[model samples]
Target: MLKPYNKKPLSYAKQVHHLQSKGLSIHNVAWAEGILAKYGYYRLSAYWYPYRIRSGNNVLDRFKPGTSFEKIVQLYEFDTELRLQIFGAIEIIETFYERN
Candidate 1:
């Protein structure tokens, strides 16, 4: 469901909500973009192929010096599902900020 990596981060929670609203899974929210390329088919599949999957830590390692996402995850010991929740909350707060 993801597009190629972009220069910036997309909305994790917005993607989650968009996917879930369509009865799709958010397991790959961090990586997937939920972009409908053609015929409404998401580029990626729902299957969590271990071989093609990378751990969240790898993504975290690339965090910018001042980013708080890693710290938040560490503070909460967020597991897969919990990470989604935390990311969702972060998205909400960011959305609120952007609108103001």
Candidate 2:
């Protein structure tokens, strides 16, 4: 397992740019991709992008009686909490973004 570290706060754009740079720096192999993809912090913006680009097609689209943005936010919050419970701290994973 990877050792944990203190996380520094960063804006969304900064984090994404850092990850893109890190991804490009490594060898283009499945192991590398797997290792990189395992960091959930790097995927946060990608997860939120769909909602940003198409707010109308969120989970609401699946149901005839639609849902609200607040519910989507709650779902994301719950998902993050669950992932943290299953893995370790989100801050621990987020720390890597600052390193790059």
Candidate 3:
């Protein structure tokens, strides 16, 4: 049988607190909360995963010392920009192909 979903929702402050407790430095709490509210903690987790330190059990519960929330945001922004550029390029190529 599958286990029941028992995860509780966290407030923006709690989310920021959790990330801080995990060694992530936030330059601006409000800004970080806005980002978290917009993209969500789980989605942002992937961006921050690279800065995390691997534990003995292979779990990434802690971040490397000096890892900043801004850095993770930068990575997320870069990914978003790259995706937009790729899509634009594909659209151009498709339009050109259709014209020929």
Candidate 4:
């Protein structure tokens, strides 16, 4: 059986606070909130996961010292751009195959 989705929604400010509590160094609150509002916490988590410092059993619950929000944003933007490029290439391939 699957578990129910009982998680409450967090405001952008709360999200920033959560990251701070986990040891992330956020340089600009407004910019981080804007990104959180746009891409959402869950979506952006993937980009920031690499910066986390895992120790013992709580591997997913902490971040490395001095991990900045800007770095995560840069990773997210790079992933987005790479996805677009890959999609464009796939489209071109499909068109060529269709014409053959």
- How far is 86's C-alpha from truth in model 1 (Å)? 0.3
* TM-score-sorted candidate list, best first: 3, 4, 2, 1
> What would the per-residue lDDT of candidate 1 be over residues 1-100, giving only the tens digit for each residue?
9888765533655644554554444345543333332212222221212213236645221223332322333333435468799899999999999999
TM-score of each candidate structure, all chains considered together: 0.23, 0.27, 0.92, 0.87
Candidate 2 C-alpha error for residue 32, in Å: 36
Model 4 over residues 13-99: C-alpha lDDT tens digits? 999999999999999999899999899898999888878887775566779888899998898999899999999999999999999
lDDT for residue 65 in candidate 4, whole number 0-100: 87
Highest lDDT model number: 3
lDDT of model 4 at residue 71? 91
Q: Which regions in candidate 1 have their CA more than 4 angstroms from the true location?
A: 1-78
Candidate 4 weakest ten by summed lDDT: 53-62
List CA RMSD, all candidates: 15.9, 18.5, 1.4, 1.9
lDDT of 3 by residue, 5-99 (tens): 99999999999999999999999999999999999999999888888898775967899999999999989989999999999999999999999
* Tens-digit lDDT track of model 2 for 10-98: 55445434534433222333433443345444444344344432345454212122323234344566887898786766676788788
**TM-score of candidate 2 on Cα atoms, chains taken together:** 0.27
Per-model lDDT: 0.42, 0.45, 0.94, 0.90
TM-score of 4: 0.87
Cα deviation of 54 in candidate 4 (Å)? 1.6
Give the C-alpha lDDT of model 1: 0.42
